[model samples]
Target: MLKVQEIRELIKLVDQSSISEFVYEIDDAKIKLKKNTTVTTVEAKPAVQQVVVEEVAKPKAVEVQAVKQETKVEAVKEEVKKDETIDTSDLHKVTSPMVGTFYQAPSPDSDPYVQVGSKVSNETIVCIVEAMKLFNEIEAEVNGEIVEILVKDGQLVEYGQPLFLVKPE
Candidate 1:
């Protein structure tokens, strides 16, 4: 497992430079770091000071609890939303434009790009994918009604991954 310090350092390096992302596998350790544009100033705040000095030392209990809680909340939310999952009986699948982390919303606290049963046109934004610090807005390829969302928010999607399965008008 990669230490928190190592992960932070990898994030720092990507933020400090023009490199969008980096990935390496050494032995059993695999490190894949993607630059978060929102985390820009946070990474640049402490180059002079050693990472140890400014880092807040948190108890393992608190860290583990937070992570567990977050995951649980996410799982519950997905479960509830699954109640609304469409039959996929007759829907067209809109695939991903690029390989990146797929975001349904512009930000975590905002509304999603599209929702179940949301009517959309050809030019409508289906989703926003953040790749290499770039937020690329994906368009609805077909004019239709959103019958199903194939992927969940915050899901890492591959190229050509189906995002929305639509029912044409």
Candidate 2:
């Protein structure tokens, strides 16, 4: 069994790397680490058992389950089909620079930084992403008019996930 410190270190290592999911097997024990926007989770246990440790940035808890082999195959097919339908050639995407909790406003009572039809320049701060207790201002790197906001306030956002779609000026 891995110690708590070992698991924490593993989570940190995985977060710093580009790999989204990691699995390791040693004898009868297995360890899996998966990274998402609002949480970093590591599950470690005997091959027949399941253990989940989730570190959430917010007060909410999110659960993820392993899929059966059959379902995984079907899910892949659906994902491919979904990807084929999206056309992003002309749209400029404002993507999250890191994994964190996405916030539409600076504070709960404040107005959102931008909305659909809001004009923006390359330096406009369109949203905030909170990661590890730090709130980062995300810029609209392209000069455009906001067409859509892809995520909701307090939503978990993955690194490189699109936060908004913009029609370039």
Candidate 3:
């Protein structure tokens, strides 16, 4: 069993590193850490007679949850793909600069910065990408009308992922 301080140190190290998941096991004790969307989960299983029963049940529950999440993601991807069927050869793409949560509005109660058919210029703030608690203003780099939004509000965006398609002026 790890001391409280040791577990805290491990969490700090993992959070600072690029790895997304870590697991450690010794004898009958196990520790698992997972990082997702800035949320961290730490699971510590100790040596006990019921440990086997718990370990068996936990994986099934996790598997079901993972499947459900995957299904939702797939549906969203399909919707995005349908939007992409439009001709985009001459359109300008506004892409995310970093891995972050894409926010269409400054606040939850506010209207979005831009929407389909909205005109934008090089300096126009089209959206926000939040990374590591920092809200980064994303601008449209071209003079154009927004033809489509490629991501949903509060979605996780990868670095360089296209956020919007714009029809150039």
Candidate 4:
């Protein structure tokens, strides 16, 4: 059975490469990845375990479901709405560097590192992304004020997914 970290690594490799499809089988576990014009799907079946990640180009109401035993995980990458009244042209986007769980604070009892209206510099640690038990500190990378947070405190974030919007200083 492949570990979660291994699965994530595979996803990254597939997304970066030109291959449209990939498959791997080891013992009772079988994994398949497929990429298309509008969506990418990853399916893993390991005995009673299964994991699936799906991303669609269109912006519709997102629905996620996870099951026990024969599990299925669905992650939908929502498109940022461009027709909103707010002018985002001058805003800088903070994106996730890898696929992981986004944590706004260091711990459950701690306050978030930054919030909307918080001033930050390039070195500011805005959040932590936990991938395979490793907590990676994510920097603001730009001097600015946090305008909005694009994800929830414990939400799963995808690679290159926008995590926040910053109004540059």
- Among these predictions, the greatest lDDT belongs to 3
Give the whole-model CA lDDT for all candidates, comma-separated: 0.82, 0.87, 0.92, 0.86
Candidate 1 local lDDT, 1-169, one digit each (tens): 5577977887777778998877766555666666654433222222255455577777799899999999999999999899876777777888888999999998999999899889999899989988888999999887999977878888999998888898988
Runs in model 1 lying further than 4 Å from the true structure: 1-90
lDDT score, candidate 1, position 115: 96
Give the per-residue lDDT digits (tens) of candidate 3, residues 72-112.
Answer: 99999999989879798999999999999999999999999
Per-residue CA lDDT of model 2 for 26-90, tens digit only, reads 66567777777675555556356577989877533332233455678899999998887546689
> Which lDDT value does model 1 have at 47?
28
| Model 3 poorest 10 in a row by lDDT | 49-58
Against the true structure, candidate 1 reaches a TM-score of 0.49
In model 3, pairs of residues that clash are none
Instruction: Identify the leading candidate in terms of TM-score.
Output: 3
Q: Write the per-residue lDDT of candidate 4 for residues 1-169, one digit (tens) a residue.
A: 7898999899889889999989888887778888665655555563575779798676444332223312322211122344444677999999999999999999999999999999999999999999999999999999999999999999999999999999999
